[model samples]
Target chain A: MEAYNYTDIQCPPPESSEIELCRILYSEDYLTNMGYMRGIMSKNEYSERALALTEKIINVCAAHYTVWEYRYNIIKDGSNHNKIIKDELIWSENIILENPKNYQVWHYRQLLIIELVSKSSDDYNVEKEFELIDKSLIEDSKNYHSWTYRTWLTKHFKLYNDKNLSFINSLLKSDIRNNSAWNFRFFLLVNNPENYIEQDRKSIINGLVLQKELKFTENAIELAPQNQSSWNYLIGIYEKFNLDINNLKGLSLKYSNFEDDKISELEMQPIISSVHALELLARIYSSSKTTVDKAIRAYDLLATKYDPIRVNYWKYLSSSLNTT
Target chain B: MVSLPCSLKVAKDNTAKIYDRNGKYHGKKQYNEGTIDDGELKFHLKKHLNYFRMLLNFLPNAFQSNDPIKMSVIYFNLIGLDLCKGVEEYNNKLFKTKKERSIIIDFIYKHLVESGEGFRGSVNLKLPLVDRSNEMNESLKIVGNYDPANLSQTYFALCILLTLRDESMSQRIDRFQILSYLKRCQLPNGSFKPLLDIYGKPFGENDLRYCLIACSIRKILQIDKIYEIEELKKVDINIENLYEYVLSCTNYEGGFGGEPFDEPQAGLTFCGIAILKLINKLDSKETNSRINYHKLVKWLCQRQIWYNKYNKQELDEGDNGIYDNGGFNGRTNKASDTCYAFWCSASLKLLKLEKLINVKGVELYLLNETQDEILGGFMKNRKSDYCDPLHSCLAVAALKLLDSEYVRELKDIDESLVISKDALNFMEQLKW
Candidate 1:
């Protein structure tokens, strides 16, 4: 009954792992994954074998979080660097830190941060890294690595301030509807209640409302239809501006009913992106009827386009087309 | 008015009739009353089979240089023959071309080994197997060591065995081993992954084309034991996800996209309907087993804009190959392709609604483009002057299925294999 049995399966662990990795690398036949990595080193013409070794380690260590942090260090320490490179390094660190059980690695990371802060002085943005680590800890409070890293970084880097605000702003900017980002913002704002006058909080909150990513508030609603935060934010903003809020409340009520219906059906659908949420909004906007034309236009804008015939978009369009 | 030596004369006439007698397409467009129109349809029909014949006739000569294009055509032609006529036709042909057949068989044998990891099709490409490694070259055309059409190509490779009537070859394929690879590619919801992911995890539901390709493989190979039908029942009614996926590819107009709902493509429409039909069968209700034939008929009809009483093309703008209308997605008002006419025509016929479609108009459209004035095999688009095996065979299948009288003229030849009787039965079994 088991799908996997040792004798029946020919997929050798390393061979399979390398084959998988090679598929992600350069897809060539002669390049047995180990040989492929060797080829990558030679092809890229790295000055040293250690640099090549670092790349190999990163490629093979896809499943290991600790190795991701180690790989980040190697890339950051190397001379050739850019914004994307720095971003990727931070992403690699975040991925490793996603699993908070690796306390020893987190502890090691803290020691490295202190050494780097003392060595680089003003150059390193140590405070931002601490904030990211703290955010990860908040997501999973039980994660000992996150808590330990947070305490260590806070002591070494001092309180989060304007120096780290840009990083915080970018996360929300990239994905405004992200609950994690919103949660982190609340913590940072409330953590230092005396940072400014009442006017500062209003301005920061207003800036967030006007931010381009506000359009994705619908996306947040789509992900967690029960999430009152986005609705509250919109209502809060509307009330402050003296705009009508009744329609928004009605939409929220409708979504709650829809969520109940979805749960009753017991379909476990994952929420992938903000645009996916917009799909549901397009539905609500259409009053439970098909939004054929608008749906088509929306999908046209999506990079990974949807299928017209399979979706009810075209069925409705066809009906409308027939009537026309 | 009947021609002499029907089979020989018909074959020759079929090839000749496909070309423009007055050569209007070749700048000699003056032919008076009662004459057929001159166009690329003739040339394309002839070219399709001719290109195929070139590989089969000179297969050894072509294989010595190991030309990928020639080999590709050869492989496709063989697979087309099997699909249209089944393994029986292939086995009969194999006996006549035994010596040359051995060479082709040997080439296939080399790749069908466990060591080769389930028959990687065509080793002559320069690209890698996965996509991410070439991230830096995102703008450049993605290349793979294996053809992107590997699943179809492998199915064709398996068809080669069935054609050879090699019972032993089927056993040697380690069907379960290959099925395991194919199963690994399936998504949790019963759709198939297009290929292995960058990290080697199989990514399912790549496209509608691949979906049909995977299904066709299962049908031809009879790979039922690999998956439990009960497990698939969980997703039997879960049409929304697949529908939504395909819907994502639709444009302003009602035309379907390439795969899982790609852009409005005639071939993909056929693919979409076929996949839906397959999914519908799994529901196990006689009433619900039938697909959304009415909607499909509407979609198929939407793509048809008649150019003349005797000619019809797809709704696409220009030549995007078989799915082309006038130019590649240029304007919907342009002429549709003969292939689309056949595909939509056949689809309507399968749904038992051929009467609802413009059968005579399509028949004339295909008839005017047939190889011999009397035999049928239409070109893809009006611009294509030659007919290849794939289109020719599909046109033949479409025509024979639509016109039973034409099929009966073959005298003792069974064309049941042409339209996939087994697939039809599979469809019927799922009828609600």
Candidate 2:
């Protein structure tokens, strides 16, 4: 199932540019189109030809959206409901395997899932979808379509529980730089109804969730110190907890093997993680007097030596941080 | 199957005059290569204009699959050409002296060439003028059957026409019918859907994008500044509820979503914020709801990811020259795209926090990397060399806002419509 060659579907011919559209749509595309024509023409019959044609188009390209629509219409008119949908789902597995990034194919899967769920909302196994997405994600880890579908499914089926946290943790374990996983983790955590907002003295439930996340993220950051997603998550937790930057000052320093008293020997830094750690430390210390001077030194190093490209940002921080 | 139900001229000869039948602009025009104020870019501004000029006259058959988004492609080209320089520069040896602007304008007016359930002609549902037109109907003789007027296409149609809106262009079509039809797309929830059929079946893809377009249409179609709010209130819609519905789309992340409970996206963020600004609800103190602009500024500033800084962009010589970092990604963890440059930049401009971004860095990523030095169009990203007119149009709009100096005679553009100030003023001048 290679994509269609451009000459196959080019308007006239032979003017192929860099990005090839589908090779001319398959002859099945033209035949399968008959199904859509039958659907739109309101012929309203689940004819074997219509079913076969729809299957051909789907087999050729799972993203053939019109064929899916026509197939759905024909099913709505008449047919074996469960078997047809289950067959389509099984067919989608091959399509998803071939084209993991096809948003349209995933959308078709989602529409089918919704149909199943609507048919028996009370009995629908939400775990099956979670597993399906988990499988799809295994194929293409950072597939935005898979992640968005996960989020939509979670919200749709009320699957936002500790189970999701474990799923995201598994993803992060595989690739510490899986930023989408990190983002999803944050979204799920923040939107959790159980994680109540701080009331009369740091609500214990909220604090526990924050502390658990903070520890979880700190573990990930230790593994891939230069991972921006981890750092963002750490910052998000710090913001969520309304914790002071001074608390993590020592950890940030040691993560880079920076000796506190020997800051004057600043030329020893080489790892990229230390630079981001230092940058975060500076942002946290924007108004702190005790660490302001050391933060300035770190900023100047980041500006001139370490990450010179964003020197404007580091220099701006160095100049402005001390002023406040 | 291209219909000619309306008596408008096709102007095939005129098109040939615009560019010879082969599609070349007929003559080469040199542009000022004066030092780009930043001096950090390795791109040629003049070449972009030339690239676009050629693409417009002789479109590649490769873009035939993009039939649905054809109107969008047209918008991008015309507006990109406009932003890159001026419409005058689009002329050549033949199209040069003979009202070249009229050729482009006529090309746009051609979308209004047919009838449907809601109007005499359903311009386009999702494709271009040549390869598209929802020709699901032609005559009203069939009493009950009629084709639906796609709201998003109609909005793009009016927005494109208003880019060249003059006095008489308003008279050629039924404005009242168009205006009434546009309003019908609004759902009771205050959000606007993208399509409304002839039998009044609503296609329920309500989002900030369509709502922005609907609001822009209302603003563009209004004849008078006086009592405009009063007229809007008179319609069978709740402006207050509509405003509230819009407010719900805002998330705590300092960004907006397509709908309530949706994730934050740069494009819809602009649509949400801009629609509010258009309807004058952005600053209203109705619910004491304050948007954390500072947090939003931080979020948006971070969207400009400089690929050279960290990621490995392994391109060959000539290709090895420019880095693709810091290009705007529409979301938190997405690839940088040409269109996001516009969406992110437009949102920043509307929010008035655009200055926080490194101006020099953005110029390099957008102009050098995504833009095809040869093709004159912008690709969606570095990985895929797939170029499209939408990307080309928005990328130029982003550039115009980044610095107007590169583009001579750049109009003061409104962030909402992304149309020039003069065009917006022209729309204002038109009476119903």
Candidate 3:
């Protein structure tokens, strides 16, 4: 389907000067294959070469629609080389207003922000990044990348600091099975430093439990027993609740070897493979911080039964033995 | 439906019947050395060679022609050629054919709209260089100007440009200019307008499918950086919603509809499946593991009901798999056609489950029902001989994907060109 051409309505005859300009500039595509070469070069080396070409590319396409794009790339590529990241972004912002639909411009802007966060000598302003993410969301409310960037802000800037429960709730309400949102929520739940604190343990676990069904998180282990992430989360929940040791061991074995006759089935299997779950379970059980000997004994039995390739089980055994 | 018991004996018997007359034991068939008549194995071998031959000969004149029709023909033709090999890699012959190949490459560059940022199908004959020049910029603004029928044109164009080792064209691309065109076409609901700046405001049924194509193209081109990753991240193409929308498109008997929340049609099924594959690539993670890719595979397998003898007449009537009409829900829905088989089957391959299909049956259907032995093209299905370039190319691609040996010869894309699924996983693991 050709775009509905309203050019008939708005396009006036090109002035002779305009036509001449088009002729002079039209065939003059930038000869720089620098981007591809830069793709092959080391970062430090490319930065110097990229700066030189950026000037040429910008000069050639400055008034052309694609110049803003080339210029943006030079800035982004050189972002770490200098402190002028904001200046490059402002140039991009001016161009994006003309082409809001330009995914390249939007992508460049995203890279700039991420660069800013990582390159900041002082801790980056998480709040400002969050605002940008929110603004991106308003542009296209369902963008997974924006949600992903937001998740970055929450982790690094401490923007979602201590409000992990509220954050999880908001994500769940938006789209229950947003896989990225679900994964992000899980990260917050398990890594909540407050979860390790004496007072916040029970509350954090409860918060994690509430968000479980949002992404069908509880069912993931049943559906794909090999999914490491799901198993990891489930084990987190088990340790959080101080579930019975023998029962948990039996549960782990039951879900270990998922059916994998087909490719899709095999792809699904990785979701439940008990690697992360086992490690978390062992850490919870061996530590005097969370539970008693029951959890440790459970880990010991599991290690013995699964015969995993990892040392988490042996470490747990020693820790439990010493504690007892 | 006749129960043709699927056994190796029957296969042997069928192969013998095909080669009974050429009975020179241990003697080679004079046509192509070492292609002897040993019965079943020899016949299958020759059949594959013929398939390859047909595909190679069917190469559209467009690659070498300056004519628009010829150029458009090559647009679909290269896909047919690649489909013959069953993988993404080029053979030594592609590199060896210097002069003719360079002509095609030159044609692409020469016709590229200088004022506009994209390539058009061909050079106009009647129009002067001046008028052609006048129209180039206007034409370029609507990069999505190509139809959903020609969705694969851009794919082929990118492939051709990439194969030519022309980094300058890609580098010269105002990635934003074309992307801007792509963005306005996207509906607020995350679907894409089939055409740029069309419908005033109404969303087309194929918008999501187009969006998927656009994103996949960006991925293939190795310019994901050009897209606003954060912008896309914030958009909520949640798997469940997409899955539900796909389900809603299903008809009572289980065909995919052309658009979201419509009756299931075969072409739309391809579109739906493609969208799902795209979504899976973009957003798969722990919490939404319930989407169940296995069930989708099962559903696709069940959709091949027409292979039954009872539906043989429908095949004869040219109702292959893709349907355009809305039938069961008090409306006539389109049936699955040749091109859709490619789309649907390719979607399955992306999920790595193409083996579940009955390769022989589909091959036979495509050969007997759709292949235009007279013209170097295929119809939508059997009984109809009118060829659409898009469907013709896709049928070849679908058939090639089913041939395991041929697929083995095809190359996987360069790692640098594609983001690893593991990297996607690592990114997903992060808090933001």
Candidate 4:
């Protein structure tokens, strides 16, 4: 509530279009705060007033990285780092809710958490952070920042456990087609630090973990045969382990019914099959010498019927197979 | 193998009702037969040129909130005009005098950081143009601390320079200082932060978007050639670590995410692939071994929507609408968007696999559904009422990349840079 002097540094002239636009879009308080903050920043005045001004500016323009960076510098230089970081954590929760899509808000939160953890390890509450991220994700389940922050949080705190798995499962349970959750699931399985150890690789590929993931993906595929996420996850698992594509031939055949030997007219419409499954089948067939004809047939069917949207891709695949 | 319940069903009707962004019925149109009326298309082009001109001159009150990224908006407007082959018209009509062009150029230069490293998003934190000797004082160190240049803004600045055919851009830009700034922005984990903080520490989410932009800045500045000049090698970013960072962000689904362990998105995937391509590491054995090339292509191809109204579940989920049959979506189970058409198509184009997708279908989607008939720019989707710079610029770039007969008026665009081929040629021909 104290008026800060801004005589030291020059603000944009009143005639500037930026000032005019700011007048139209923002409040007088926002403009005054920004002008004062510019002076404070130029003078290297990392005071409580400067910090407060940054918060005001950030509230109006959450995407401004300059304001966020200045605020971080203020916090780092402040006497009570832990207290200010905790306050920032709480303050940014509201900012995130107001602008969940803003990358700066999430990045600022990450900075606050890092500072909090470094200053007072006991004060770094992982659950609170998770809750905030969950709320943000609830607003937009596929929010890039929220998901990225969540991943960073989990990895940073070494919280890759059953709880994380269950959270991802709950997301998938709500919407099986949530590719974000599916990608997170893959991350937890393959990219976890614990899984990166030399011995864990074998366990991941040959152990019950792979079996469990396969069954989960299979069930998802069965529920929605056309879901590309499930199909992609399934293919990803096999490809990651360097497993044979033929292993998926049976599951793929269940969804894609096509006869390779039967000669058909170019205009004939095939039975409506899962385009994903057909694509998978084509990959499986194309990989083997004996089934090249089958791969061409599947591509032909996809080009003409099931997935005509990517007909050129299919034809390209078929021709490549023929050349080989 | 037992047959599973087939959830995939094609629409029985060959045609569906067309609607504008406001949901006004525009009569029935056959699926996959989105043709543009030449007269209407030409009118739309005129409107687009007018819109670009307006954006470049002065943004309307509606875009007042976008003050922070005014540089990007200018770049979009310039690129949009170039794509429409309206730069000459723009010059002749709006900015006839050399002084006008110089004024615009000076405005951009005003946003450059005092350190001469990079450009700021805006002049909001404009510092006094102090002399270099005076700036070396301890008290003036805050100049370097505050108003740090952003990677994205720097990229946009260079692109704007190229679009404007600023031949002296190389001289104006401090390539070594920018390269040093880029080096500072890179985290030990290999990802580049979008911006730096007061103490020159890299902050912000590690994203492929920033990575791609960093690569672009490096390419535009010709930083790679600095290695041959021994004096400049110290300023170069650690390309090995950057490459590792990119590879680490790849999802099992064969698409790249914005960050590591994030969901694969078309835009980020484009960023990832484009980074590899820019660095000349895309076709390397290490990259080939790591990336699932076929799967990436499949994922990119599958972005094109083949709408089937009979699929009730898909309809309920808003996966694809009748109006979006030929459009591309960013992710799986997402509705088609105008920008993703460029992201997906350009990613494929970078891989020399552009012909794999139905190019005609993309043209149809852009022309008939997202292209605003009455207004100039392209909308995000059929449901959006107004068009913004991002979607409009990308939509035009996508059309240019496709080189479709429907939009032959559009000039060719460099897929990686997303600028007119002429602009790219100008950049390539610049002698530093």
Candidate 5:
């Protein structure tokens, strides 16, 4: 399906080649674009004339942020709630589908969402936001725009629960290294989750929430032993609280695959950055240098053998061990 | 796969070969077998000089795909030339006489909106929306209406002018106007937006990128160094809030992202550290007290991805890639690209940890692997044949970080502006 149908809005051919040359030299589209630019530049009153101009221009060019900013001022100042804002939401969806990476399109849509919610949040239709994000994220799983907007929707409209966690869980199952989903899971489980900040600080990450997150991440790590996202989630949980670094030694050792005598896994080497879990385990043994010596050596082996590119980083870590 | 040009052949022998378009025997050419030393490969100065000069031809499609980023393409293309050829030499070649420099400066300055210190992507193209001759009275209507200015473009324009400025170049801008624009664009939270609305509130999103742009502009204009802005305009940087906003963007992973608690990225990490360095907030004592320097340094070093110099056909079985060329990636496990070499390594430089990187490997990657053989511009990656101005510009800058032989001719670049120390000196010499 075509994302945006600008056929009706495209500049029609001039009457003849002479006018077309004139159009090329002094293109009607250029005039339209510059008119909006000049309006925003001069802070001109966004009259009905400016409104018509914006409608025509945004029809063809949604990336012109100056035009969008001008249109925002015009609508907000004049209180033009005459159904244009709703149409703008639909138009923004078309733009988003056409150009998912265009940041300005998402920003414009967000401004429209704010306008609608301020008028009467009950009619905001937040499911549209969810659906729009779903489509965008499906296209690019690492898109922070959709993830950021998802956080806003959850905070403003209470759109998260076990269902959201389950969806993210399915995403992680599909690709165990989807960092965006892992980050979203942290937001839901930990700090400032879904208006949870309004409640007492202690209620933010209560025992149940922490337990569930630990279990979820532990299972994820078990499923994909080499996925850095799983390890990052485990470390993220440890860092979120003022928990002792020593406490994670148990989880680290649990995730460790020292006993898995798999040759195929040995050939397909683990990533260098993924050895943070092993390093954390080494650190846990740091109280006594003699006790930590073996784990530290294991860390070196992982860093050097699996990820030879970052031998310098491994050397740094090993040297710091002696100093500490 | 990108469609190979007709004259090129994807040879079984690894190196791409120049061939006749038709299926015909192409004459044998000797392939350089051994790994070339980084010191041996001279900067392809003439080809790069031609590469950037060709961009100015405006071949009707030179910047067609980059229509939205017109200012950036112009600014970085000029910078790419300046890095390959000396800035003064480039000045002599592009604009010889004083009159010529003035003309080019005015062309850039025309993009500046009168309301603020910002500049738009380009001069707003005038279209014949209304028949000015027939439908309107020439005397009654307004003329010379232009587009609004933005933070990124303003940053590009000011630096471009400063680089192009010499002794005879005049300071045409009112510093107070630009300073006030930057000040007003700051939100209560201290991060900067791209532009401010008519209400003096921010119009767009706030991020580390805008913050860096604002601070870099501050450094170039030397708003603090100049005395006039204190009385003429309110020139306060909500220091408390700004510091808090920047600190908020710092991640537990020892890198920064666009927002607090977001995914850590190399580019945003550069912006954050560069902002701190620019504003004189990068105190090692206070910052290291909180931030894990070991992790941060380790994280930066790990951004060096495995970049094998040899193609598949050239690689022997069981080769461990010990002597492969190295390049920086933006994220933890992403493919290496040209721009992040500057972003990641420059941040490491600011952190006093540049020594940890494999300098020789990176220099060779920038000079040999990523550089296009035919056009002399850097591509997004080793595999890409297309030339991107921003990538080419940053690769040259990253090459400077490696202390390449070109350093003697090129200007010394500080971490913040990515400009020649000489050009920055020239910027400092400008009087309001």
Candidate 6:
């Protein structure tokens, strides 16, 4: 039980003008501990005490990249990485729960998982990782870090199964406006790990899967007419597959009927139409010479009443259609 | 359309007289007709200048957790000062002498991790220059080996140096090493990590932000020239895959997400488009085919919050507030935020569609709602009382892009770079 000789690093005096609030917020004891840790880190001392100090430092400043880097280095240099990795995983889960929005914690977790997999793939539990990420997502469904990590894990582990799709489906069922879920659905459909080849993915999407997804999206749109996520999903499916917008023309007309008489009175008292449906009808009509006028009328209505915030955009679209 | 409860009267001298609904005088300003409250709206340049100056000197305890990316905070403050046309005056006050200027220059350079070949976010990891040279060779070696340089920090440091007009920046910067660092940070999938581990493995979130920063660093340092040199070819990035990665992030909604299969966001959309513009692939056939260009423009335009009551009712709950009528939101079904004004507008500006949105509406929203009249600096939203550097800098930059009468005093910004046009010109003149 020898005492560790702490180095004396000159910390800025409390009264110094350049002292950042980050430093000022630190207690004297905390600052002293950090100074000692820094002294050890500078000397490249990768010991148990140094490793323990990193934990102490990280608890306070989870976003501190340097401490995370130091901790990773210590674990990398350790003799028993299996034990360290397991312990760190459990430790980081708590840290992540406390700071779900922290960029550094998720990254550190990624590093640890990558390291663990590299050492012994059998020991790496994909289910546990999923549970952790799912818990994080439950806390905040739109958490960008959590979603990104989930996507990365899916691709990395090739966990493209019913579980993944059902998870996304449940998310959508709860909140159809969750664009993140819609985006993930697109990713799952197109970049399914099972279909490694582009041709395979194309064939899969062109099959009954495409019809099912389209129906699901259209139904979601019907439930919430203004929800842009479902509309974007429908549009994404069509554009990515090069499907004709005319296919949705029947559905588009259900929400917006742009007849000659209706177009004439759009300026006086605009009909209550779904903005998305009107835009879709406009896109569909602009494709053919016979219906181009109807497209212009739709754009005019959108510009004047439905979506006046983007009047210039609608006007630009109408003008472009005219030139074509 | 709901008319504002105000009217404008123009005089012979181009000065506008603003009156309330009752025709009582409100204020007078040098204004143009048709612009919303151009006569009464104020830029509050002096107040914003003081705000930036104060932030530069010291950030409050509220920013305690942001200690790691201190360079970026400095970058935001410096850019804000530049936007306010206060950089020269502030520099004169802070760095009155050559020695003082060199001290700052030296301080920034100290963050450079020699072994990592990039700049660390802060100087906390590395010992002081005197200590490193005299008594801490072992510590210095460890710091050099273990200290990771961040992509964003590297970008921020380079920009700060350029803003300071550091003549020797090109010479002082180790271009080859930094390029090597960038090369190491790139993943096999063409996305980039913000930092590398001690083992030289890129480990961090792979997002559009890092990709954008990586591209910016490459452009600023002119790393493409490395390919001309036989030995330096290893430092070059995979431009083809990088382009593919950026295009892959394009959402069906026409905006981009942080990563592929993520929700399209205004900030990431800007980064994605800016990356393409920087790499000269914006108009490539692949880009034209991969992206729905018209849909992207429509999506960006859709970000503007309108004053219409019907549209407000249709929008997400809690977004019915009238104060955000002209501001832009980062995503669909989201409330308007101060930064998205710059993000969406700049994205449109890059697409050559700046005129597609109502610039007057944006100006009015920033001035009347988000701009903190008493404190200076812009808030995140109308309801926010606090103003930070990010929102304030972006609000000003967004205004500068509009080149409206309200922002006539502010210097123009290069939309893609988000730096003042004059500063960009100065950077272009540098030897690097």
Q: How would you encode candidate 2's per-residue C-alpha lDDT over B1-432 as one tens digit per residue?
A: 111111112122222222332444522211112111223344456766776666566565554434334565556666766666545444444255445556555554544524421221212121211321344333422211122444555656666676655345667656555555665667778887555533354443466777787777666666224435666445433456668787777654556766664556788888877877777776667533556665566567656654222222111111211234447767655557778878877887876756555565566567656767675667786555467668877877787777634454455577787777767777777766
Best by TM-score: 4
Model 1 C-alpha lDDT per residue in residues B302-327, reported as the tens digit of each score: 44333211111110111122212111
Better of 1 and 6 by TM-score: 6
In terms of lDDT, the poorest run of 10 residues in model 3 chain B is: B322-331
Q: Using DockQ, give the best candidate's number.
A: 4
List, in order, the clash count of every candidate structure.
Answer: 60, 18, 57, 0, 1, 0
For model 5 the local lDDT of residue B67 reads 47
lDDT string for model 6 (A52-104, tens) is: 77877777666667678888888987887788888889999999999998888
- Scanning candidate 1 chain B in windows of ten residues, the lowest lDDT window is B1-10
lDDT per residue (tens digit) for residues A212-311 in model 3 = 4324555655544433334434544444456544445545544432222133422322333443344345444554545546455545533333322112
Q: All candidates: CA RMSD in angstroms?
A: 19.5, 12.2, 20.6, 5.1, 8.2, 7.0
Ranked by DockQ, the better of candidates 2 and 4 is 4
Q: What is the interface RMSD of each candidate, in Å?
A: 20.1, 11.8, 19.9, 5.1, 9.3, 4.5
True interface contacts reproduced, per candidate: 0.00, 0.01, 0.00, 0.43, 0.14, 0.35
Compute DockQ for each candidate against the true complex.
Answer: 0.02, 0.10, 0.01, 0.40, 0.19, 0.31
DockQ of 6: 0.31
Q: What lDDT does candidate 6 reach at residue B91?
A: 64
lDDT of 2 by residue, A135-174 (tens): 8787568776677777778767767676887888887787
List of chain A TM-scores, every candidate: 0.31, 0.75, 0.37, 0.87, 0.75, 0.86
lDDT of 5 by residue, A237-259 (tens): 77878767776766776644433
- lDDT: which is higher, 1 or 5? 5
